[model samples]
Target: MTIQTNICPRCGKPTEEGLCPQCRAADTKLLACEPRVTAVYCPVCDSQKRGKTWSDLRMPREDLIAELAVSAVSIHEDAKNLKVAVRSEDTASNRTACTVEVEGTLYSVPVSETCEVEILWQKEACDRCSRISGGYYEGIVQVRATDRKINAYEREVAASIAEQAEESLQQSGDRLSFISELEDSKDGVDITVGSQHLGQEIARMVTGALGGRYTTHPKLVGEKDGKALYRVTYSIRLPFYQKGDVVVSRGGYFEVREIDGRRLRVFDLQTGATRTLAETEVERLLGNVRDAESALVVFTQPNMVGLMDPKTYRTRELSAVPWTFPVEGQPIRVLRDEEQDRLVIVG
Candidate 1:
């Protein structure tokens, strides 16, 4: 093959190919020098792929350490807080450990940032989030960070959790599911429950346990009887006409009383086997209450989140956070609206 030379882009030098010496030294030329590659194919095109690049400290090591030490004064801590340090004697080795404090509780973790404390990494701050209060429809803040890897990792985790929450809602027979995507984090995971009233490490633990999935969505589109319930689209298991019994529906359950006009009555499957509900009560029996399109379902048990009495198309007054951990026998939560382009999950 014959080699060709072209004018360098940054320098007035006649060089082989294109980029100049200055650009190469600026870490902008190509990874042919860095060894990092996003792809092994198409060498020239692949080398231009952007990746993370750490910055260097302009101050002396002593000053850098002192600055970090002083900055720690306002570090809001939690169960994962750590006391990090590298003594003067060990400065040569650049070793350190972590001591954390959260909610007045302390714990030690094995962590070391010794080697060369990347100034770029030190520039990062803890992540913060704000979520609405009450119910699963309320979105939440996970965390915030400047590092690309941390951001990517947090996004992936949030996606996994959101995906699970949606699935749980569907399986539980929710009317509709809608939601926004999750945020990133540099400190730790943050999440909100229905109404945004509660957010804590428990959310993180739940997210992790459920393979990073959970939601605060509620049952019944609106609030009733003081609490938000899950609204759903489901079948009403109806029974033969009856006199007096409780009816079940995809939305919730209700008791039947007296019949009115042209209407068919249904009976309860339980002890009130032959009892029939009134026409007005029949309407309640087949109630598929309006759902707020959240993942939270009203059910006494997690399983109940999916159950509805066919005999009366009625459901119990209950809702769930839709949590699941594959490592455990628990159910999984998948947010229905996480798909980009508003795509739906099938099979």
Candidate 2:
């Protein structure tokens, strides 16, 4: 009887099928790396660009370098237990040299390879920064007060809200939603935004926090890509009576706690009760609590309290409410009611 034994055709070694593991592993390339790769980034914002899309860099510089280096390397399909390591150094201001080492098993034989890849750094403005530089804006948010100019406090709040909205949108990957300019006009604050979505967000947030409403106006600018482009204006109108205002309503002193449409939520300074009143019921605005003067309590009684006025340095008598207690030595908040020639205890 005659028997046939299998042997590797090229290596002359014993094998189960065609070629031995060592021979096959030696014939295949374990790792292949590109000679050079290009990395695009925004100079102003440090955003990374992958192909045609730009994104904020969320990784450290070293990690980014390692990632870019590994991306330039390709391993053989049959390799198993693959492991890769990268080391990089800055060769120039715009060039990075990287060494990529890979280890794995191919055809049941261990193999390894190391190669060099050069990274060519390129700079390009990101979408948001480009729009800002080119003065491109799709909407304007005008923050104004009803029947008056916006106060300094309102201007500060509006500007802060606009910036916060821009930051939040950009962090959530809305790259085109940016604030191009924040200007303080004679009437109010003007926020120029790169997208109408950002304008709407700022307007909504401002009105929600400060108590008001907004209206939108759209004007046709031109056409792009067979689509009509319109620039929007978000007109935000703050209420006439803002929070913290001391007002006279129905022969009583009340503090404006909130403004809702044509009504005002008031806190009665004399009775220490909270109630709602129509805007037309308010007789006059004394002053905002923010401008209230601090007075020292000279004496306290059941129905009346004596205070040393800050403006005149003279003792004045005012009625106290049950909501707040007056300490004989501590200073208390008081608003001057010029119409009644008396001090109103606010808190």
Candidate 3:
């Protein structure tokens, strides 16, 4: 029988096949890095652009720099246990210089390589920024109260809700959804949005928190990319009676708790019970619970409680309710009924 042994062709060393591990590893290129790579970003919003797509930067600057550097490097397919280290510095205002070092095993032999890569940063306007600067909007939300103008508190709530909705949508990757402008008009607050989705969200949230309903009206604007485009206007009307209002209904004083259309869910101050009343049954509006006065309790009886009137500085007796017990020498909440010349216990 005859036996044959394989030998390395280039080094004349004993091997399995054509070349030994050390010779093959020496001949292979472990890492190849491009000399330069361009990074495009928005100057206004700092959004990064990659292959004709713009996205918000979600990584730190150092990590992003290292990623850009490593992206320009190509590793050999036969390399194993590869490790890369990158160091970068800003060479100019829009330029960065990077050094990449790679260590790995090729064909069972350790190999290492280092390369230099330069990154050129270019700035351009992003989609959202461009639309905002151009005063482009797809929808408007108009907030108004029923039969009256919106108050300062309502206006503030609307504006705050709009801003929160914008932030939520932007963070959820809806880049085009943004608030273009928030304006306060004579009637109410007007919120202009870049997308219909943002406007709808703002209107829904405002009404949900402020007790109101909204209606949408769409107008044909034009056509884009063979699709018909329409601008929407969301009209929101708040209820007449808001929460915390103290109103007189059917010869009884009640505190408004919630407003649902023409009906109001109220707490009966005289009986300490919760009941619903129609808006038309309300006789008059004395004041809101927010305007209640702090009266010092002078005396407490079995059927009555005596309190010092904050305005008159005199002791006044009021029929006590079973809901709240007033302790002597403590302050109790009272709402004044000017027509009846009396102090009504609020709590």
What are the models' TM-scores? 0.17, 0.85, 0.85
Writing each residue's lDDT as its tens digit, candidate 2 over 1-347 gives 11477788998888877889999899999888899999999999899999899998589998999999999998989999988899999999999999999998998898999999999999999887888898899999999999988899889999999999999998998999988889999999999999999999999999998889999999999999999999999999999989998899878999999999999999999888899999988889999998888999999999889999899999998777899899998999998888788888898
Q: In model 2, which residue pairs have backbone atoms overlapping below 3 Å?
A: none
> What tens-digit string does per-residue lDDT give for candidate 1 at 222-266?
666897755321111112322232345333233343333334343
Query: Which runs in model 3 stand beyond 4 Å of their true positions?
Result: 1-7, 10-18, 270-272, 289-347
Q: Kindly list the per-residue Cα lDDT of model 3 for residues 121-164, writing each as its tens digit.
A: 99999999999999999999999999888888889989999999
Local distance difference test values of all predictions, in order: 0.32, 0.91, 0.92
* Runs off by more than 4 Å, candidate 1: 1-136, 139-149, 181-206, 209-347
What is candidate 2's TM-score against the reference?
Answer: 0.85
Candidate 3: clashing pairs of residues: none
Name the runs in model 2 displaced over 4 angstroms.
1-28, 77-83, 103-112, 293-318, 325-332, 338-341
